[model samples]
Target: MEGFVQNTILITGGAGFIGSNLCEYFLGLGNKVVCLDNFSTGHQHNLDGFIENPNFKLIEGDIRNIDDCNLAVKGVDYVLHQAALGSVPRSINDPVTTNDVNVSGFLNMLVASRDEKVKRFVYAASSSTYGDSIGLPKVEDVIGKPLSPYAITKYVNELYAEIFSRTYGLETIGLRYFNVFGRRQDPKGAYAAVIPKFVMQLMKYESPVVNGDGNYSRDFTYIENVIQMNELAMKSQNEGAVNTIYNTAFGERNTLNDLIAYLKKYLSEFDSKIADVEIVYGENRIGDIPHSLASIDKAKNILGYNPKYSLQDGLKEAVSWYWDNLKEK
Candidate 1:
């Protein structure tokens, strides 16, 4: 991160959990950041802390629109493309909207970046790309058939990125994110991620439901580690690093039961009654892989990426943030 030059960066979905964090981080790094979001899944309140900054600009637009993509990428040096309809169940329910945003929107951004001659295009890929592969620790080279529409869309993004890199000479890096969770992640929706959603339920002394017997595991990554990978992908000068995919993860897996235990432990600190909250188990949802763990060796060796947060470390921070910022509401 040292000796990195400041440049104007465009973050699609800049008002969502991860995108908003990127916006705040890059703005703090003395770079001009233009945020483009349609506010469908992204919340406007996520931009509150830094919205007034002169270095930050907000474009109320959607990535599905080519003109909006073009207008946002104009004069931008880097594109952190994170806009997409994310959720296995939601994607199952509405594949069309998911494809329109994840696939078509991604293509629009790539075209805009190529046309604008942006320096690099870093995107938010998903571990769902690993799909039905039963491999314990997933490596970049291998993958299985996608299990859901959401997985299909993310894999398509990677393919499109590689094609754009080869066919258009654009610099691209795809970060295959695992089950990412942290502050500002929405905890209210039916499609809300498990971590934040469970946290909210426990805070209210309600039973947090587990989809299965709670043995399904994931490489739960932290937001800060994700930020690190994005920055490294943008600034990496290594010849072999660009135009490749890297697993942006903590390289460790935890089961849902383990996650619940930690969540209860952390939340109990704020309210002792949270310790008594029960967890309910239901039928396993469709299109869910039994386990997911990342092999980050490629990212570390190629991009010099080192994730600074473990799950417990990040959960502590996330729980604290929710307690202070959201528990009252």
Candidate 2:
């Protein structure tokens, strides 16, 4: 049954948090995996466990290089392009580099995959692409202006992907990830996501800083749900799923205050010390959307997407992983 999967699967940026999880999942299903990464933003430790897997191959290369893209795509049946410069503040600080990697690198991979005649090209899009579209439960067809460079780059990916499918006869699926978090997610770094950053701060007995009012909310999706979406996007039989973008989220929203309270409660059980830590509220970040939620009806209906983990359920699992692996360190 496992052999029915496309044997040769190429995952660009395969060592990053979500990419690494996808690599492990598809490989476990008995597919030969090729992981291409430059390690600029990804860690080597992400792929350390899979290095010895006979069916897995790692190509230490950059997506910015056309030859590297060509080399990685050779004989590959499916391409999961996940490499991108993420983070709104990082893009605000250095928009040029973000555009270079997210836009240019993305196009390079698209060109190479089309030329290689891959069966499917599924890439990571972002909820940021929704930008200033103030509407709750963001749908696919409508989008507002891109507020940040990172947003621009991601929106460009959908544009290029759509063009390739129409003009060059390629199959492309875009998954707009909303705040994905899980095991193997790096909690250290200035650019770390909210979950990891808060976990790290709580473990060190430091106050977790909440930007703006703490009432700001997000539709925080779990990493395992994203892995399911990617696999389903790459393997779906419905023609409607091709050349389309789907919001990959758990369809739930949580305010920063609610999230902080939840985190504090969970961490306190491990060390009784975190129970006393205070949360500091600061000025809101520029270019940050005040609230975000996703309408996952399209994905559920078209791709048979069923998210198994809700926020509380996923956080229970994730916080436990952090407790075991990160807290002691």
- Best model per TM-score: 1
lDDT of each: 0.95, 0.91
* Model 2 spans with C-alpha error above 4 angstroms: 1-3
lDDT (Cα, tens digit) per residue for candidate 2, span 1-329: 23336489999999999889989988888899999999988889899888899999999999889999999999999999998888999999999999989999999999999999999999999999999999998998889999999999999999999999999999999999999989888887888999989999999999988999899999988888999899889889886889999999999999999888888888888889898998899999888998999999999999999999888888888999899988765
TM-score of each: 0.99, 0.98
> Candidate 1 — which residues are off by over 4 angstroms?
none
How would you encode candidate 1's per-residue C-alpha lDDT over 48-117 as one tens digit per residue? 9999999899999999999999999989999999999999999999999999999999999999999999
lDDT of 2 at 309: 89
